[model samples]
Target: MSTTTSPSKHLLELQGVHTHIGAYHILHGVDLVVPRGELTLLLGRNGAGKTTTLRTIMGLWQASQGSLRFDGRDISRLHTPQIAGLNIAYVPENMGIFADLTVKENMLLAARQARTVAQIDEARLQWIFGLFPAVQKFWNHPAGKLSGGQKQMLAVSRAIVEPRQLLIIDEPSKGLAPVMINNMIDAFAQLKASGVTILLVEQNIHFAKRLGDSVAVMDNGRVVHAGRMAELAADEALQRSLLGLAL
Candidate 1:
């Protein structure tokens, strides 16, 4: 007799997603699933459409085909803000900080958009500060003045200020020093420990191998391999074929 496995505990799923940027079609048909309380990493070489997949999921760009399901409900074509309102947060590569605004102000902007903003609670703010003390220290400084790592922290903090079902992040370690990357990884780990589901698009294989609960490898806009993190890390030849990297 065979036992059937249950659906994921968390609430994010992408099925046969196809996306196009301008005249170019990037994701021919991609499928992704992220369980709650797990860190799911999407990995690929440059131009593999890793970031584009995140955009399509966030509804920044409409999907020409397939379904995006959150909490077992279909949300394939919802507006961007609408998707955000459903407790899914997105932090893109640029970090989207307000250059002229102070660190506190940028957070405040995100706070106001949250359902609990009217209450002005500091619990989440305090938690954010605890996760990234640098933000607390730079509260009064313009967000533009922060280092690359600090800005990435601020972006992530802002995205998660609200209670979210899914947090989608793009290239959190991109363009950061070794120390900053470590800091970001620690932050992500902390987030995972809190039982928040994360779907990340990352290029750093080492980082992905360390934090990813499951790995999805993409190539030419298609996901070529999906498996356990340890399986990929242990196979050298698979790494070369999928990522063009020996390690």
Candidate 2:
């Protein structure tokens, strides 16, 4: 098993974050760090506040307490658009695709600075196509016609339509077949190779074990464990104790 004291550099950091949805409190003093150029996995059982933490980071839900920092700048109170403008991309579990639109149109919509496909960087589009062949195959087709896995690919493609510093994705492998999950894992590996920081909320142990550089496990709205993924994967007892299953 491998271990480290801490990351050398953090691209994103959350300190004591708390969230409230109406009268109910969700997150409580949640602390997480996404190291530069590394994939950080956020894992927990159902209703563990994993999704709420992601939403809070994206400004979809306002944090009632604590500080959020991206690249050394404070962003605790920023709205969604302003936060997105900082070159961070988020893909929720729903995949957030426009069902009525063509895949090409959907990509165009995510490219905020581009009005047409021609305006998007050709090399970047080619790279995205390489990462997700399904996206390229269904480029001109209505998003609604694609299967669940295909829609997830389109969602990730849209998130990377423009170059981004950080990619925050929720459950990329959720409900996918083994083959589809492998494809998603490969795509994420390539994205990591390109040096984009990533924070992922994932339940699939295989997916997380294969791709995660660092891990944070949450329970009842707070982080309970933080360490190298390799260490967690190597220790079955730790896995069972924290995740209730061995990887």
On TM-score, the leading prediction is 2
Report the C-alpha lDDT of model 1 over 132-165, residue by residue, as the tens digit.
8998899889999998888999999888877777
Against the reference, the lDDT scores of all candidates come to 0.86, 0.95
Clashing pairs in 1: 10-36
Candidate 1 CA-lDDT value: 0.86
Q: Relative to the unseen true structure, what is the Cα RMSD of model 2?
A: 4.7
Lowest summed-lDDT stretch of 10 residues in model 1?
A: 112-121
lDDT by residue (tens digit), candidate 2, 1-247: 9986653499999999999999999999999999999999999989999999999999999999999999888899999999999999999999999999999999999999899899999899999999899889999999999999999999999999898999999999988999999999999999999989999999999999899999999999999999999999999999999989888
Model 1 residue 16 CA deviation (Å) reads 1.4
The best candidate in terms of lDDT: 2
Angstrom error at residue 137, model 1: 0.3
